[model samples]
Target: MENKKALVFGSVLLSGILTFSLYGIGSSIASDDSKHEHDREYEYRDKGTNYSTKSVGTNKLYMEECGSCHMAYPAQLLPTQSWQKVMLGLEDHFGENAELDAESHNSIESYLVQSAARRKGESRKLLRNLGNKTPLRITELPYFIYEHDEIPCRFITGNDKVSSLSQCSACHQNAEKGRFDEDDVVIPGIGRWDD
Candidate 1:
């Protein structure tokens, strides 16, 4: 009777351990699924609209001057100081004709400064990808460089729409709206990243 009782007790303990392990595994999987769902919802929210409520000055300058040959560089790509430097050097802007009237230039500068990259918190994907150094040029972004690194350098020069690497909006669909996530990246000729 003692042996039988011991056997029964052992079996009960084993069953309890098995049940607890299964429950733990199941709960972990459920937690992962919930996290994935949350990520999906965040991506959905980012895809809502491309309209910006910020100052129209930058957009105006971009459309009028920069948009003719290539897509406008997103304001968030550079820190305010860099934008200030770029604005100050409009006459010799990256080997192109970026000269503008005094009023228009001031407006553009103001807009760029207001939406500077330095203002981004650590939580922002751009800041995370950028790491330590503040990127002055729009093309200097780690993600942007990584995404375009595979493309032949000649392609940028040959393509009128993407003359320079700075023209992110030329390829990325939601660039103007300040959304640079992996999901939003859609190259003009190239479809999408396999990953």
Candidate 2:
């Protein structure tokens, strides 16, 4: 009877471990699914067009430093190398003295690299048309040009509300939240962006 009881206890413990392991695995998968739900929904609804999947999340240091000057543009918008170039040239950041302390610079660089577009799935297309060129500006990306090709200059550079295409949040209402669904765009002065 003693031996039987011990076996039963061991079996129960093993079962519990298996159950917990499965639960953890399932939770990880579910988390990933929820994270990319926006991407999946957009693809389903749009049929062919695509947008960069937002980063896993944002970094506070990056937001505080870069965002204080310009909208903390989503890091996923650029490739790893591009982000490296941008961070490396902070002293001459678009003709401004945007250099940061070593600690802050390192932190921001890591965040950007981790969040940058890897050459996978739709991200591969993001690097398309660029033959080994590491573009420092998001506006210089080929994909960016292709997407905004339709918008007239008058609506961007000419419009006071939107000084340039760099002001993503100007038209993309949810840009700061890493959501750039074309449907949500509301170009200021102009109503909704049909294109």
Candidate 3:
């Protein structure tokens, strides 16, 4: 009977030690993750803005269809009129047949229209320098051009990893989240963008 009691006590003690060890490891891992997130936020804050937390929401159908070919840019990047034009010309979308079924097209159109950049809001900066022109391409927007004008062509077209400025994800790590802060840019072969 004494041996049985000793065995039981040993088992419980071993279990407690194992549980404590696992808990410590888990806590350490969680702390590391928190540190990483803090560092990322600090980097964005240091850049004079905090676009790192932006989230434009998401659409399943839109991501499945449009995102399959290219980055499904945040709808706020364009205006309602521009999205309408793009949807109307899906048969020749940027030199490709991107037409969708009526059901899919209508749904996607509604989503884009609802989230398009408004004349007054977070997207107003994207609409600047426009004098009643409907641009079908985000890259053609005056604000976009102005933001990228300083980047040399060689760093883009010449760099195999980044064929064009249209591929926002190629440089902007958080492009999918609607975060285009300058500090988030890291050109493929070159490095972090200083200019």
| Winner by lDDT | 3
Candidate no. 2 TM-score? 0.71
lDDT of 1 at 31: 99
- Residue 23, candidate 1: how far off, in angstroms? 37
Give the alpha carbon lDDT tens digit for every residue of 1-195 in model 2: 999999999999999999999999999999998887755423212111232333222377788999999998877788999999998899999999899999888877877887677676445656778779999998999988988999999999999999999999999888887766777799999979876
lDDT of 2: 0.79
Point out the worst 10-residue segment of candidate 1 by lDDT: 40-49
| All models, RMSD in angstroms | 11.2, 10.4, 7.4
Q: What is the clash count for each candidate, in the order shown?
A: 0, 0, 0
Error of 2 at 155 (Å): 0.7
Which candidate would rank higher by lDDT, 1 or 2?
2
Our model 1 lands, by Cα RMSD against the true structure, at 11.2
Candidates ranked by TM-score:
3, 2, 1
lDDT (tens digit, per residue) of candidate 1 on 1-195: 999999999999999999999999999999998886556412212211443644654566666666666555566666676688888777777787778888777777777676656433522444546656655576676755775687766557667766776666666566665555566665555566445
Model 2 / residue 136 / CA error / Å = 0.7
Residue 162, candidate 1: alpha-carbon lDDT: 68
| Alpha carbon lDDT at 17, candidate 1 | 100
